[model samples]
Target: MVIPWLSVLWAAPIIGAGVVMLMPRRALAKWVALAVSLLALGVTVVIAAGFDPGGEQYQFVESRRWIPSFGTGYILGVDGIALALIVLTAVLVPLLIVAGWNDADNAAQRRSVHTYLALTLAVEGMVFMSLIALDILLFYVFFEAMLIPMYFLIGGFGADRVASSKAAVKFLLYNLFGGLIMLAAVIGLYVTTAGSDAFGSGTFDFRAIVAAVAAGDFAVNPAVLNLMFAGFMFAFAVKAPLWPLHRWLPDAAVEATPASAVLMMAVMDKVGTFGMLRYCLQLFPDAATLFRPLIITLAVVGIIYGAVVAIGQTDVMRLIAYTSISHFGFIILGIFVMTTQGQSGSTLYMVNHGISTAALFLIAGFLVSRRGSRLIAAYGGVQKVAPVLAGTFLVAGLATLSLPGLAPFISEFLVLIGTFTRYPVLAVLAATALVLSAIYVLWLYQRIMTGPVREGNERLRDLVPRELAVVTPLIVLLLVLGIYPKPALDVIDPAVGHTLTTIDQPDPAPTLADGNAP
Candidate 1:
């Protein structure tokens, strides 16, 4: 039998966290955490090596009973999307640890670094589990459980601990409320599935759930399905922090450390969109179709609103937060468009965004650390003083703006092209944000990095080895993906096709000039 790669991918960090808690020397915990995260990355590489890019089925699947009475089991698997996300989670956690090497100011606080590392590891483990989980109950369990570590990560460590605590509380409350609503949906789905021929027997296996929904085996009411889909969609929306429901993100991201923000924004938030693709579109195709127009409207609104708001922000971190809101809008739009290019573009966007956003946060955090400020006004002529740092920022910023020859551009272009074929007006409206993105990013760079040296800003340091170490990989990835995306897309397309097939949707063919096949 093949090794249980998914279990190993998740368990390494939890085991590492346990070992970290036992470490006699507190300083060693970060190293241990880093080693564990790297190990997880290595395992993911092995999984990828063995992964069949052509296969649409979940790979490395392993299932065992968790609660017989509830028909719940510890089911785990990954498609290309899940594998890519698992890799992202693994890649980011170690960088997060490194970024926080000296986060605590006092000896007392320093002693608790182990706790911080342990909590981070816990989050990594849980996130991996959430990505790979094939049981609805197990998915929900990991989904909700990962938030605890994040709450502490935000609250316990940051530039403003007290304010961070408040943000954490807000984040927790929002997610928990959403999760509870999802729980009701899960129960509702379970009840609808009982005695259904589609599942063979009552089970919380996600595949079975999908099969039941697809076959119309469950005699669920349309109204009930709509309500359940809304619940699931809302929970994910809150997590995506999509407009209106997105209020928690700026607060949490602004208050949290750069590392925390990386996890929160770059890694964790993708779970929300991933759920929309995985469960909502695939399992609740009717509801997804029913709600497409509404979701598309919200996504377009978020794109323009986030870009406009970002242009007005003074705080660097908060501006990035708002920009994420805009980027997420694109991802959402791409997903709801339901075209092959749109789906593939959205999936690719998730990975590309994570890498580019990490470079922004980490480099920005490094700048903030040296200058002791996050306000754009406080920084001036930084490029003159630290050209390398300025260059890094420029590359990352260009990626954010979806400049050609960078990763986001390809994905963004694909999204718009695919969307235009089916959603012409929406595509045009959403494309306006591209100009807005350029304004905010270039304007921010000009204000912070290009002006005459501000008082007390003349002596700012360039990117240190540690900071470079943290950011280099992400930068390399952005360029590599921009230049050559086919490897990733090869893995992603089959899964995208599977999802579209499950939803019984096909890409809309382009109309010929003569209204005939060319």
Candidate 2:
């Protein structure tokens, strides 16, 4: 009998969250949470090991009727695109639990440690469900639901309670507004399908809709389709926090605890870009192609805007938040470019950015915890007192700037190359962020980690064993994926080819001196 791998992968965390909440001791809760996350990771690894890159587009699929009357169902599956993110989510949650081990204990308005850990696992489960849900309605339900736990994680536990609360509200308001629009879009899609003879009673199954669309059976008015597409795209763009819609990210990321912030940015946020790839492009190919130019333009603007803003930030955590905006810009750019390399790089970027940002932000959080400040001028020579911490911080910082031989470097290279092929001028414009990123990262490092040891910084302790355990794996993954990204690329490439094929996009052929396509 075939095992329900997708069900097992998603259910483990949610069940573990319940078990964690029942634990009597804080230490027990922490260990149990870590063990549960590790279990999820193990399950993910087994699934990955069993996954055939060149096999069916979505492997380990499970489907069952949920509401036959409304045409919705319980459906789960994993393509390579989704699988890569599943690995990222699974790997990061365990470390995040480890990193935030004491975050709740020290919060000004303290909550139970079990509550915090349970919420983290809850978020993990919801993210897992969102990534694998093959039914559009199922995906949307969890997509909106994950925000509740995240809202509390931000508002209830942070260094500054008031700021964290405000940030949480802003985060909620922005995403909820986007989700509300997406709800209308979801209904619109269902209504459209219900009317079409192709689907009979209508269905929310993603594969079914894509097949109908591919067969030209999804005969809907262009104007209505564009409107529905806008509804969905608006929500995703807001979630992806692209440019103008990105105002909530910096505030939320800065105010939340480092681990919660990483969960939000590194893992949760990828759902937005992932939706753009799976739903927007496949469900409404014409609409996606129609708005491609506008999306690409916004992406380039975000790349430059985020980097430029980051350079001027006085707070360390806020600076890192802005850098994510810049990095996300690249991911969105790659997705909209409609090239194999671009999409693959975008997919890989989601994972690499998670590792790199987790390392940088968590390390910065540790330093802030030590010094009790997030200011740039708070320290002058951290390396003198805590050489190991300083060294790790430097490596993470370099990775953030996409230094060569680091994980992010290859991802960024492919994005630029992919974009340049289709949109040269915009690619050139986006490349300027490389210099901008270098300035901010190097300058931030120079100010915090180097020079003479500051008066207070001299007493700062290096990373403890727990912190080392958290930081070491992330750093090693950055190095390993950096030096050899082939393993990941192998899984990602075939999925990308499928997406490009579905969208009717082919990689551009190079031309010779005679102007003939090669």
Q: Give the top-scoring candidate (lDDT).
A: 2
- TM-scores for all predictions: 0.97, 0.99
* Candidate 2 segments exceeding 4 Å error: 513-515
lDDT of 1: 0.88
| Worst-scoring 10-residue span by lDDT in model 1 | 102-111
- Name the TM-score of candidate 1: 0.97
The backbone clash count of each candidate, in order, is 0, 0
Give the whole-model CA lDDT for all candidates, comma-separated: 0.88, 0.95
RMSD of 1: 1.6
Q: Per-residue lDDT tens digits of candidate 2, residues 398-417?
A: 99999998999999999999
Over 10-92, each residue of candidate 1 has an lDDT whose tens digit, in order, gives 99998999998888876777778788989988998899899997865798889887898888888888998887787778778
Clashing pairs in 1: none
lDDT of 2: 0.95
